[model samples]
Target: MASMARNPLPGTIRKDGRRAFYVYLSPPLIRELKKAALDEERPAYELVEEAVEALLKSRRIARPATDGVA
Candidate 1:
Protein backbone atom coordinates (compact mmCIF):
# COMPACT_ATOMS: atom_id res chain seq x y z
CA MET A 1 0.00 0.00 0.00
CA ALA A 2 2.92 2.34 -0.51
CA SER A 3 0.91 4.05 -3.14
CA MET A 4 -1.84 4.62 -0.66
CA ALA A 5 0.61 6.05 1.85
CA ARG A 6 2.17 8.34 -0.71
CA ASN A 7 -1.09 9.43 -2.25
CA PRO A 8 -4.21 8.71 -0.31
CA LEU A 9 -6.71 9.28 -3.03
CA PRO A 10 -10.17 10.59 -2.22
CA GLY A 11 -11.70 7.25 -3.19
CA THR A 12 -9.73 5.30 -0.63
CA ILE A 13 -11.09 4.35 2.81
CA ARG A 14 -14.52 3.59 1.52
CA LYS A 15 -17.60 4.37 3.59
CA ASP A 16 -17.78 0.75 4.67
CA GLY A 17 -14.22 0.83 6.00
CA ARG A 18 -12.59 -1.02 3.20
CA ARG A 19 -9.66 -0.23 0.93
CA ALA A 20 -9.16 -1.78 -2.46
CA PHE A 21 -5.75 -3.33 -2.92
CA TYR A 22 -4.48 -6.35 -4.74
CA VAL A 23 -1.64 -8.77 -4.21
CA TYR A 24 -0.27 -11.32 -6.59
CA LEU A 25 0.94 -14.18 -4.48
CA SER A 26 2.93 -17.11 -5.60
CA PRO A 27 0.82 -20.27 -5.51
CA PRO A 28 2.67 -21.66 -2.53
CA LEU A 29 2.05 -18.54 -0.49
CA ILE A 30 -1.62 -18.66 -1.31
CA ARG A 31 -1.83 -22.23 -0.16
CA GLU A 32 0.02 -21.45 3.02
CA LEU A 33 -2.28 -18.59 3.93
CA LYS A 34 -5.32 -20.73 3.20
CA LYS A 35 -4.00 -23.59 5.28
CA ALA A 36 -3.20 -21.24 8.14
CA ALA A 37 -6.68 -19.82 8.10
CA LEU A 38 -8.19 -23.27 8.09
CA ASP A 39 -5.93 -24.53 10.85
CA GLU A 40 -6.76 -21.53 13.02
CA GLU A 41 -10.48 -21.88 12.32
CA ARG A 42 -10.74 -18.31 11.14
CA PRO A 43 -11.82 -16.65 7.98
CA ALA A 44 -9.09 -15.94 5.45
CA TYR A 45 -9.90 -12.28 5.46
CA GLU A 46 -9.32 -12.10 9.21
CA LEU A 47 -5.94 -13.76 8.83
CA VAL A 48 -5.01 -11.38 6.07
CA GLU A 49 -6.16 -8.44 8.14
CA GLU A 50 -3.90 -9.54 10.94
CA ALA A 51 -0.97 -9.69 8.56
CA VAL A 52 -1.68 -6.27 7.10
CA GLU A 53 -2.12 -4.82 10.59
CA ALA A 54 1.21 -6.29 11.62
CA LEU A 55 2.91 -4.77 8.62
CA LEU A 56 1.39 -1.40 9.42
CA LYS A 57 2.49 -1.63 13.04
CA SER A 58 6.05 -2.36 11.97
CA ARG A 59 6.23 1.24 10.68
CA ARG A 60 8.33 0.18 7.74
CA ILE A 61 7.90 2.46 4.81
CA ALA A 62 6.70 0.43 1.83
CA ARG A 63 9.00 0.60 -1.12
CA PRO A 64 7.98 1.34 -4.64
CA ALA A 65 7.11 -1.51 -6.93
CA THR A 66 9.74 -2.87 -9.28
CA ASP A 67 9.12 -5.21 -12.19
CA GLY A 68 5.44 -5.05 -11.21
CA VAL A 69 5.91 -6.67 -7.85
CA ALA A 70 6.21 -5.16 -4.35
Candidate 2:
Protein backbone atom coordinates (compact mmCIF):
# COMPACT_ATOMS: atom_id res chain seq x y z
CA MET A 1 0.00 0.00 0.00
CA ALA A 2 1.19 3.50 -0.84
CA SER A 3 1.00 6.31 1.66
CA MET A 4 -0.89 9.39 0.53
CA ALA A 5 0.45 12.89 0.95
CA ARG A 6 -1.13 14.99 3.63
CA ASN A 7 -2.90 18.22 2.82
CA PRO A 8 -2.28 21.36 4.82
CA LEU A 9 -4.59 22.00 7.73
CA PRO A 10 -7.22 24.65 7.34
CA GLY A 11 -6.14 28.25 8.04
CA THR A 12 -2.52 27.26 7.75
CA ILE A 13 -0.20 30.10 6.74
CA ARG A 14 1.76 29.48 3.56
CA LYS A 15 3.82 31.91 1.49
CA ASP A 16 3.47 35.53 2.59
CA GLY A 17 1.05 34.31 5.23
CA ARG A 18 -1.78 34.27 2.74
CA ARG A 19 -5.24 33.42 4.00
CA ALA A 20 -8.13 32.11 1.96
CA PHE A 21 -11.38 34.04 1.95
CA TYR A 22 -14.53 34.13 -0.12
CA VAL A 23 -15.86 36.92 -2.28
CA TYR A 24 -19.24 37.19 -3.98
CA LEU A 25 -19.39 38.15 -7.64
CA SER A 26 -22.18 38.35 -10.15
CA PRO A 27 -22.60 35.45 -12.56
CA PRO A 28 -21.60 37.56 -15.55
CA LEU A 29 -18.45 38.71 -13.79
CA ILE A 30 -17.61 35.19 -12.79
CA ARG A 31 -17.98 34.04 -16.37
CA GLU A 32 -15.78 36.84 -17.61
CA LEU A 33 -13.11 36.13 -15.05
CA LYS A 34 -13.04 32.46 -15.84
CA LYS A 35 -12.84 33.14 -19.54
CA ALA A 36 -10.06 35.65 -19.06
CA ALA A 37 -8.13 33.27 -16.86
CA LEU A 38 -8.40 30.58 -19.50
CA ASP A 39 -7.45 32.90 -22.34
CA GLU A 40 -4.40 34.23 -20.51
CA GLU A 41 -3.40 30.82 -19.21
CA ARG A 42 -3.02 32.38 -15.75
CA PRO A 43 -4.62 31.73 -12.44
CA ALA A 44 -7.62 33.83 -11.48
CA TYR A 45 -6.02 34.70 -8.20
CA GLU A 46 -3.17 36.51 -9.93
CA LEU A 47 -5.59 38.73 -11.79
CA VAL A 48 -7.45 39.44 -8.57
CA GLU A 49 -4.23 40.33 -6.77
CA GLU A 50 -3.22 42.74 -9.51
CA ALA A 51 -6.60 44.42 -9.42
CA VAL A 52 -6.48 44.72 -5.64
CA GLU A 53 -3.00 46.24 -5.67
CA ALA A 54 -4.07 48.75 -8.30
CA LEU A 55 -7.11 49.69 -6.29
CA LEU A 56 -5.06 50.22 -3.15
CA LYS A 57 -2.61 52.40 -5.02
CA SER A 58 -5.43 54.44 -6.50
CA ARG A 59 -6.92 54.97 -3.05
CA ARG A 60 -3.57 56.20 -1.68
CA ILE A 61 -3.31 53.26 0.65
CA ALA A 62 0.13 51.93 1.42
CA ARG A 63 0.80 48.21 1.03
CA PRO A 64 3.37 46.92 3.48
CA ALA A 65 6.13 44.77 2.09
CA THR A 66 6.31 42.38 5.04
CA ASP A 67 3.08 41.56 6.81
CA GLY A 68 2.45 45.18 7.86
CA VAL A 69 5.75 45.36 9.74
CA ALA A 70 8.04 48.26 9.12
Best by TM-score: 2
Instruction: Please provide, for model 2 over 1-70, each residue's C-alpha lDDT reduced to its tens digit, 9 standing for 90 to 100.
Output: 1232245456555577765656999999989998999999998988888899888776655645566643
lDDT of 1 by residue, 2-52 (tens): 786777788877797877676799999999999999999998778998998
| Model 2 misplaced stretches (Cα beyond 4 Å) | 1-16, 61-70
List the candidate 1 regions with Cα displacement exceeding 4 Å: 1-16, 60-70
| Pairs that clash in candidate 1 | none
lDDT of 1: 0.81
TM-score per prediction, in order, is: 0.55, 0.63
Best by lDDT: 1
